[model samples]
Target chain A: MRLLFTVILAASLSLSGCAGTQQKTLYDKLGGEAGVDKIVTHLVQNIGRDQQVFHYFAEANVKRFKKHLAWHLCDISDGPCDYTGDSMKQIHDGMQINERDFNHLVDLLIDAMYKADVSHRVQNQLLARLVPLRQDIIYR
Target chain B: MWKKLCILLPLLAPLSIEAADGKLIATPGVSQIEGAAGGGLVPWAQLAGYASRDEIAVNAFASRGSVDDYSLDVFGAQLNLYDRLELSIAEQEFKVDALNLNIRQRVLGSKLRLYGDIVYSRWPQLSVGLQYKQLDDALVANLLGAEDDSGTDYYIAASKLHLGAIGGLNWLWNVTGRYTEANQIGLLGFGADGEGYEWMLEASTAVLFGRHLAVGVEYRQKPDNLGPKEQDWKSAFVAWMPNKYVNLTAGYIDLGEIAGSDDQDGLYFSIMGTF
Candidate 1:
C-alpha cells in the first residue's frame, strides 16, 4: 500500500513538472504570417464595407491600409515585420474620433479575429498590447 | 483494525487539509494583475487580459460623493486560461442614477492577454486586441436615441509596473488608441459626416495598504467626436482583494458634459473573478 501511494505521488509530480516547461511562441501559435495575413484581410474587408465608418477610408488607399495593417500586426506580435506607418497619434491627430467610433472598429476586428479562428488566448494577448493606444486614438 | 484506522487518520488529515487548501492554489494558465477594482485606465478589464483562478472571481461594490449618485453590483467568473497568455469573459451591469436619468447597462465582453508577465528584468508588458460591445440596442435605443453604437471597439495597450517598494507606492501608466471613422455608431450618436479619428489617454496609480488591500485612481481624456469639441473625465477608486481570484472596487466618476448638459457624475462598483 505504501509503495502504491509513493508511485502515485511521484507520477503526479512528474506530470505537473512537465506541464510547466512547455514553451509556446506567439508566431508559431498564430501559425506564422499566413495566419496573420488572413486575420488582417478579414478585418480590412469588414472595415471597407462598414457604411458608417468606411467613409474615413473612401478617399484613402486601400492597398496601403492593408499593407500597413499586416506590418503592424506582425511587429506587434514580435514577428519579423517592421511598421513604418505614421505614429498612431500623428496619423489620427486632428480626427475627432469618439468612443463609439472606436468601439465600432473594435467590434469589426473582433469579428474578424473570430472568423479567422484566432484562439482566445492569442486574441487577449494581442489586446493587452493595443489597449494603451486609447490615448492616441481618441482625440479628445 | 481500530488501531490501523487511527494511524491512517493522521496521514489522511494532511490530505484533507491539502484538499481544502487546494482551493487556495491559483488555477493554472491564468494571471491576475494586482490592483483595485475597475477597468484599467484604458477601459479594458483589470486582470490585464488574464482570467481569474478556477475561471471564477466574485466582486461587490458601493460608492458615494465625487461622481454624484451611488451604485452597487457583483461580478463573478472563472479565468479560462491564466498563464503566459490569458483569456476571460466577464459580465457587468451598472445601475446608474444621475442627470435625471436612471438606467442600467448590462455589458458582456471577452478579453485576451498575450505574453505572461509585462514586467521583466528588461521589458514592460504589452498587448493589443479588440472588444465587442453589444449593448441592448433596442433597450438603449428607446432610452437614448437609435442605439447605432452597439458595435466592437479596438485598442492597443502598453503597461509598465513601476518599481515602488521603496516608496510603498505602486503605479502603472498605459496609453491606448481606438480607430474611429465617421457614420458608425459611437458612444454618443452616429458619427458626423466629417468626423475624424479619436484617441484616449489614461494614467493610473495604486497604494497598497496591506497584502490584501489597495487603493487606486485613474484619469482618462477622450475626444467628443463632435468636431473640435473635446470631452474628458477623471475617476478615483479603491480596490480590495481577499485572494488571487476575486477583486472588489468602488469609485467616483465624472463624464463631463455634452451640448450644455451638466457634467454627469456617479459612483462605480466592480467585481472580478479568475479561474
Candidate 2:
C-alpha cells in the first residue's frame, strides 16, 4: 500500500509538472485569439446541437455570441483583448438559468476546450477563473 | 445469489434510456456503506448518480468486507430526484465468525441538498441527512448491553471540489457533524446503560486524477455506547469510474475495536451501477 501511494503521488506530480515554469499565459497555451475563436465556435455548435440547453440560446444571435464569447475567453485568460460584451449579470439577468442548465453549459465549454486541443492544466486554469462567475450567471 | 441477480436486472434495464448523464463524470461520487453517495464510510454532501435537476437517477450497489473475526455484506439502492433530494435503503448482514452467528440491520436514509454546488458555487455544498437504522434481531445487541434495537443518525455535511488545487489535479474534501448514539454503526444497537445522543465528527479528503480515478482517506468517530469499546474507524480508498454508469471502489479499513475485538483491520470492495 505504501508503494502504491508513492507511485500515485509521483505520477500526479509528473503529470502536473507539464505546466512547466508558467512562462506562458493561459491565452498563449490556448493558442491566442485564433484558438479562442475556435473554442467559441465549437461551444456554439455544441449548444446548437444540445437539447438540454439549446432553448436558452434559441433566440440568441449566433454571430454576436461567437464574437463576445471569444472576447470573454481571451480576456479571462489574460490575453490582450478587451471584452466589449455586457457583464455576466447583465447578459443573463432574466434568463432564469437554473443550476442544471448552467452546468450543462459548462460541460459544453469543456468539450469545446478539449476540441480546441487545450491541455488539462490550461483548461483547469481557465475554469478556475470562470467558477467565480457562476453566481452572477445562475438563477438570475 | 439468484435473488440478488433478479433485483439487479430491473435496475440495469433502464440503462438504455440515456438520461441522467447530466452531471459531470465522476462528480456524484460512489455509494457509501450506508447507501449514501460518499466515500467508503463517510457520507458526502453530493447526491448519488449523475442526474441533474431536470432528470432522475437510480443506483444499486453491493459491498463486502472481512476483518479478523467478522465479515459484512451490504446491498443497497438509491434514488436521486431532481438533484434535490435523495432516498436510500440498505441491508447489512454481519457474520461473527468467532461466535458463529449473524447479525442483520436495515438502514433507511434521506438527504437534502441545502445549498451550493460542490464545484461551482463560491461556498461549499451543504446538505442535511438522516439515517434510521434497525437491527433485525436484538439478541446480540441485548447481550452487548445496548439500550435499543433501533436508532437514528442525523448529520450535516459540507463538501467542495477545488479545480487543479493540488498538483494540477482536482481535490475534494468533506466535513460532517453527526448526532447519534449508535454502537458499532448500529450493528450492536443504539445507546448504552445511561447514554443518549452525542455529536461526532467525520471527515474525508480525496484527490482526483483526471475524471476517472480518485484516491482518498476517511475518518469516522464512533460512540462507545455499549459494553464493548466502540472504537473509531478509518480507511484509505481508491475509486474508479469508467463512465457515468459504473463505479468501483476498494479500501483498507482500520476498525479499531468491535464488540471487544481489537485491531479489526480488513479490506473492503464495492461496485455500483447507475441508471
Error of 2 at B155 (Å): 0.9
lDDT for B113 in candidate 2 is 96
Best by lDDT: 2
Q: What's the CA error at residue B74 for candidate 1, in Å?
A: 8.2
Question: Could you report the DockQ of all the candidates, in the order they appear?
Answer: 0.01, 0.44
How does residue A126 of candidate 1 score in lDDT?
Answer: 61
Tell me the tens digit of each residue's lDDT in model 2 across A90-128. 999999998778877888998998998977667777888
Top candidate on DockQ is 2
Looking at candidate 1 chain B, the ten consecutive residues that score lowest on lDDT are B20-29
Best by TM-score: 2
Candidate 1 regions exceeding 4 Å error are A1-140, B1-41, B44-80, B84-110, B138-147, B165-170, B180-190, B226-230, B258-260
lDDT tens digits, residues A5-116, model 1? Answer: 3553465456446535757555555667888888888988898889757876677787887888778878877887778889888877877765446645766775787788
The TM-score each candidate achieves on chain A is 0.78, 0.89
**Fnat, 2 decimals, each candidate:** 0.00, 0.42
